[model samples]
Target: MIRTGILNPAVLSLLARVRHTNTVVVADRGFPLWPQIETVDLSLVDDVPTVRQVLDAILPQYVIGRIFAEEEFRQVNSPSVVEALRDHTGAIPLVFEPHVEFKRRVPHAIGLIRTGDSTPYANLILESA
Candidate 1:
């Protein structure tokens, strides 16, 4: 049996394989869970398990250096989300990028966590450290 949070099988597998500097994605439901990238589908419904919840759970144990999100989220003034992240991990610097460019980055990520969140442009790229 697992001893802590984040017992999701797929998530555990990805986290196990990820090494320092490897990039991972904790994405909202709207983002596609591409087969090319290792995917952890935790979505139950429209908002079953949010991106924030999943990220918060894993950040405590994972050492991630950089976290990148769609540039749109920065423009939306979603400081609460960013603030919460600071509690668990170091600065998750926000980056603004074209939507197309953002989507293009996911497939190359070492892991992709699909959440049930509905927030716009809520995909994030987390680099392991």
Candidate 2:
């Protein structure tokens, strides 16, 4: 029985399998689903559980080495959204690549977490340290 930390068994299982340098994706609701990767869909409704909320939950439990995001995230999202994302990503090096390049990396990820966040290009790929 677990008393604290991540309580979701599916999420726990996914994180447990992550090795150093491995990546896991915390994606927005609109992100495309990849058939090759394992996904734990937590989306309930529009913005029910946001990308930030999922990041907040997993950050404490996971040792993240880097964060990969789409370059269009900054261009498409509002200033507040960008700032909020920055707050969640504190200290972890963030790399922005083209959206096409970002999707190209998804198939190799350990797993995908689907959140209800509607923020444009809010998806992130977190690499284990």
Candidate 3:
């Protein structure tokens, strides 16, 4: 049996299909998942598995081109979460897009990892590198 790397079957499936410059959305629990897009739901309970946590595990395995998150999340009064993201992704810059725009963009994502994070609009669309 497989005993190394990603143990999550869904995550492993998405990771296998991800390629350079491909788009993947690591979104909040409430983020809408389009029928046409592939979704990897890792959420078990509220804040059980954070969006950043998921990225940390997946990003190292996959080469990501860039990341897109809501502009509003940057101005968050609680800087801890954003700071965690900054620390997690490092130099990979985050592009700010409106909420509607974020939703519109997810449908085109090659894969979407839905997290249980309750943070406001804690959604990130990443471009495979």
Count clashes in each candidate, considering only residues at least 3 apart in sequence or on different chains. Answer: 1, 0, 4
Query: How well is each residue in 1-129 modelled by candidate 2, as lDDT tens digits?
Result: 999887889999999999999999999999888988999999999997998899999999999999999999999888898888888899999999999999999999999999999888989999999
Candidates ranked by lDDT:
2, 3, 1
Which residue runs of candidate 2 sit more than 4 Å off their true CA positions? none
CA-RMSD of model 3: 1.5
The CA-based lDDT of model 1 is what? 0.77
List the pairs of residues colliding in candidate 1.
71-96
Off by more than 4 A, model 3: none
lDDT per residue as tens, model 3, 1-129: 677667898888887887767788898888775789888788999987988788877776888778888977877637887787778878887788887787888777788888998888888988977
**Evaluation by lDDT, superior candidate among 1 and 2:** 2
Model 3 — which ten-residue stretch has the worst lDDT? Answer: 74-83
Q: Of the candidates shown, which would achieve the greatest TM-score relative to the real structure?
A: 2
Residue 121 displacement (Å), model 3: 1.1
Candidate 1 vs 3: which has more TM-score = 3
Candidate 3 colliding pairs: 21-128, 63-129, 64-129, 65-129
Which candidate's lDDT is highest? 2
Estimated TM-score per prediction?
Answer: 0.84, 0.96, 0.90
